[model samples]
Target chain A: MEYTYTRSVGPVIDRFFSGLADRKIQGIKGSDGKVIVPPTEYDPYTGETLSEFVDVADAGTVTTWAWVTDPRPGQPLQKPFAWALVQLDGADTAMLHAVDAGDESRMSTGMRVKVHWCDEPVADLAAIEYFEPEAS
Target chain B: MRDIAVVATAQSPAIRKEERRNEVEILMPVVHDLRKRAGLKQEDIGFTVSGSCDYLQGQAFAFVTALDAIGPWPPIDESHVEMDGAWALYEAWTRLQYGDIDTALVYSFGKSSPGDIRRILSLQLDPYYLVPLWPDTVAMAALQARALLESDGVTEKDLAEVVSRSRKNAKDNPNAQLSGDVDVDTLLKEPMYLSPLRKHDCPPITDGAAAVILAADDRARELTDRPAWIRGIDHRIEPHSLGVRNLADSPSTRTAGEKAGVGNGNVDVAELHAPFSHQEIILKRALGLGDNVNVNPSGGALASNGVMVAGLQRIIEAADRIMAGQADRAVAHATSGPALQQNLVAVLEGEK
Candidate 1:
């Protein structure tokens, strides 16, 4: 028995995915003027449909994170990694992604990191394999 | 608003795993027990609603089969929420507001033991980004717990304290799945299950069900000498995306608590639906529960969380205390979605 379905990510988010396929990230400016990466069709706060899409740097700083000692199925990087809220550069909002920092000891808040893109462009969040510490 | 009160309630003992009974069977004794206590049969109930998710059993409309407990022979006025029983109770409470219904039967059941609950919960996340990550519930909670630790005054020790108190308080709750005299120091020593959240910080995957009978003014008086009168009830929700919301606080809960008029009177007890230890801290602050308030005297969702059932159980626990004359004013809270994104607050009181 299997239940499989595809969700429509809508027009605004579809563009964000397309950007990811080309190794680019985009943010939508909400009615509140906050640029939200992984853009939504409408503003999360004001419920207004967004029209502007701004390109954002793939690199960002970790606002917060939770280190996973044991990885679950389908998670990025089966080894020990941290699930972090990375507020990418040029975007006011954060994006949730796995940070392949090797161990819990390496993970820290405010750590500068950049996206680790997948070998092949895939028009999905998985197009970025995982985020890693930018310099090291 | 027409006066309505919780006159009677019943719940199965939270079990880690119920190998024998299916969902209907587990709900039978609970619903029947409430009927017996309220002296009302199936047909007498003006409205019937339940809360249960099909994901646990891996079948769509799986809740339809649960009607076996109600005996559909005569047919009944029934509805169900895909979320938790707390929301179903809210629906029944709303129905009573119409002044047409005299009584309602509310119940919820869940059997997390049969499924990979972590994976199932991930399905609730945004399909494109978060779902693909497949972060488990505990990991999500750990994220909030870490943020709370970093930003708020709450410490890891504070989380352990919540866990310790939950175990101690649950001793009085015969229906609770886990209860003991574990101390905070001992819990803090336990290795992290998902860093910042220990095994004790998370709720046990419980298989159980709970039911409550709601009666209007006069009918409520006739059913019980004391009734947990519904003073006010309201629920609110924050953004679904955890990244957008503040992980250290629960604005939805605060808004719901305010709308429910929790501050109108002195609350003696509060049954908060905080499945994770740190969440108790966040909810406590959001609802403005001072040190004097007795929180989760029934050990809350921490003692035994059956997902869909735990929220309604909070209402039952608070109402039961009010009905027992243990407290005059009490607040019962229920939460759903990731990291307390959705919240329901109900203020119940005893007759003056």
Candidate 2:
């Protein structure tokens, strides 16, 4: 028997993805003033609930990366790609995403990349297709 | 820290297809029987935990529907593992260590016959490299069996012997799905489902649910004069990739067994979760059990392999022996992931 799962996105996450739909990155600022990437509902270090959302720039520097010589099912990339931990321009921590760098030699830590949004945003993680290196 | 014991265990009859009812309906009777036999009410349970795979149910959050059987009107502290019931028991044991909850209920249900069991297991592999080829569970176990045969000089006859013994043992267990007296010679002559493995060598496709109740210290004594005290429990995981580790040897099981003190003294009874015949031999070697250990006195997984639930049933069966004064100390084991990539072992004992 086949089964399907319909997950209900909570309000905090819904707003985060809605922001992504507008090609904008949002982060939740904790009481400590540290901005969290992917906009967590609660502060991990303080254990306090967060409500303040701030827009962060999409352009970011790659912090660390692992090349996905072969991509897996449900991943953002269908072809050879690099999975980079990117610290978005105004965020304090890194978020994982596919890096479309054409080849392995072109991808490196500290390289600057810009978000390449999907043609149509569906309020899902895949709305951001992948990050590609900025044109030299 | 408080001592916890598995007081009661009950399971639905294993079947190829339980079409008349869904998971909740299938589980209600088992839950009722477990509560009834343990002489306890639903309200008496301090915590509940379950083990199941969303993949097996063909739906995510399958356990959510199953919660209906427990009747959550009062609300209970609960958690779930995307693993076998044995791991749920491990979590319950850990909870008991805190002395917060005295009584906990652990259960698991699976409908292995619903879809292609082998095909579904391929998802457990590293999704990127190995899964595209769709290597099923049987083929992977076959690889391990092949390694055992080539390296250790284990013969086909030995595999058949496990099947024969398991079926004979199952004759006494009404809950067993497959059981009968079959000659090892006849089993060896049967056509190979996977080469070097006969039809009986592999577990029959079974759909079933099982539940076990754990009571700690005073509650255990109040529930039964003979409580099967858990002496030790531990589990470990190996890397997901098959190429990264040795197939013939289960290092995870070895590590868990040592931590659980399987060979601390004498183990009168052993219940090892071996879905295939050769896995039993591999587990025996891994646990370092000699000829003295009475292995799978309750027929083990060869008689009824109920996916996520079978492993916990092993622990329950071993505990039953101690509770009934049939044995003093015993070892029970559970395995998960592809080719036994994860393992849990526990030691149970009765009052001296």
Candidate 1 lands at a TM-score of: 0.98
- Candidate 1, residues B1-352: lDDT per residue as tens digits? 8999999999999999999999889998898888999999888899999999999989999998887658766878889899889999999999999998899999999999988898999998888778888878888898899999999588999999999999999999999989999988898889988887888999999999999999998999999999999999999988777888899999999999999999998989999999999999999999999999999999999999997999999999999999999999999999998888899999999988
Q: What lDDT would each prediction earn against the true structure?
A: 0.91, 0.82
Clashing pairs in model 2?
A: A3-B58
Q: In terms of DockQ, which candidate is strongest?
A: 1
Docking class for model 1 is medium
- lDDT tens digits by residue: candidate 2, A16-97: 8888788888988866897777776777545688999888999898765545454544556767676665778888766656
Q: What is residue A42's positional error in candidate 1, in angstroms? A: 1.3
| TM agreement with the true structure for every prediction | 0.98, 0.72
